[model samples]
Target: MNRLYHESEDWVAQGSCRQYDPELFFPVSTTGPGLHDAELAKAICRGCAVRRECLQWALRAGEPHGVWGGTTPEDRRYMRRDLPLPAAS
Candidate 1:
C-alpha cells in the first residue's frame, strides 16, 4: 500500500479531531453513547478537506476500528464489499 503522509496535499495532518480523544473515534458504545460519539467524530470529517483520502487510506489499510473518514467500521466493511478487486499482476 502507498503512504499519503509524505505528500504535500495530505490534509489528515490538519484534521480538527487531532486534539480530541482518540477513543472518541473508536467508541465501544453500541447504543446512544456510541452513536453520539460517532456523530461527533463525523462532524469533524464532514468539514475535512481530506475526508476522501482519509477514508480511502483506512479502507486500503483494512482499518478494523474507529470512525475514519466519517464512517464507522461497519460502514467501511460495506464499502469494501462494493469495491472492485485489483487486477492480478
Candidate 2:
C-alpha cells in the first residue's frame, strides 16, 4: 500500500503540489540568486500545511532525487539527518 502521507480526497484544494513533479523538479544548479529550484522547493515548505508530512515521506521513501516540501537533496539531508531512515525497500 502507499505509505507516508498520500493526498486525502480533499488535498487537491491547496493547488501547490499539482505543479510538482519529481523528475522535472531536479535542482537546476546555476549562478543565480535565491535557492536553487531544489532549495526553492524546500523553502516553499515554510508556508506549506503539509511540510512535516512531506519531509517524512521523502525520508522514508529514500528518495535520492527530486524536491519535497520545497526542499532539495541537501536541504532534506540536513533536516532528516536524525530521522529514522527507511531503506528503499
Candidate 3:
C-alpha cells in the first residue's frame, strides 16, 4: 500500500511509544482494564512529535486494531467516515 508520508521522513522512529512496551499500544480490549492501557498509550502519543503523521497513516491503511495515533480502532472508524477515499493506483 502507498504511504501518506515519505519513507525518509521516518516519523515512526520518533514516536514517544518507542521507549515503551509495544504491547502497551495493543490492548486486549477497549473496555475494562484494557482501557487503562489504551489511555496510557494515548498519554505517550500526546507528547509524540509525529502523532499527526502516525494517525494519518493508520487511517489511510485502514488499521483495524490497536491504539494508533492515540486513537483506538473504533475511533478511527468514526474518523474514517468523513475521509475522502484514496485514489486507485
Candidate 4:
C-alpha cells in the first residue's frame, strides 16, 4: 500500500473529485464567480463517500483555504467557531 494509504488517508482515493480538475476545489475567491466554483465543488462532494472524513480532516488540520467536504473556507471557519478549542498539551 502507498504510504499515504497506510496513514489512513486512503479515502482520498475514493473521492469523487478525483475525476475532476483539482482547481475546481481551489476557487480564487468566495464571491461572484467563485461562488459558482464552490457550488460546483460542493456538488461533487455531495456524492462523495468520504465527505465526512474529508471535513473532519480539514477541520482538524485548520485548513485555511479552498473547499473541502462540500464546504468553503468561510463555511469551515464558522463551523470551527462552534467547536471547543483543543486542550493544552
- At residue 16, give the lDDT of candidate 2: 55
Count of backbone collisions in candidate 3 = 0
Clashes of 4: 0
Model 4 lDDT on a 0 to 1 scale: 0.77
Worst 10-residue stretch by lDDT in candidate 3? 1-10
Q: Which scores greater on TM-score, model 2 or model 4?
A: 4
Evaluated at residue 59, the lDDT of candidate 1 is 88
Q: Candidate 1: which stretches are off by over 4 Å?
A: 1-10, 83-89
Ranking by lDDT: 4, 3, 1, 2
Better of 1 and 3 by TM-score: 3
Per-prediction backbone clash count:
0, 4, 0, 0
Write the residue-wise lDDT of candidate 4 on 19-62 in tens digits: 88878888998787787888888888999898898889889988
Whichever of 2 and 3 has more TM-score, that candidate is 3
Give the 10-residue window scoring lowest on summed lDDT in candidate 4: 1-10
The stretch of ten residues in a row with the least summed lDDT in candidate 1 is 1-10
Greater TM-score among 1 and 2 belongs to 1
Name the regions of candidate 2 deviating beyond 4 angstroms: 1-15, 20-24, 30-35, 83-89
Model 4 CA deviation exceeding 4 Å by range: 1-8, 83-89
User: What are the per-residue Cα lDDT tens digits for candidate 3 across 47-82?
Assistant: 889889989888898988788888888788878787
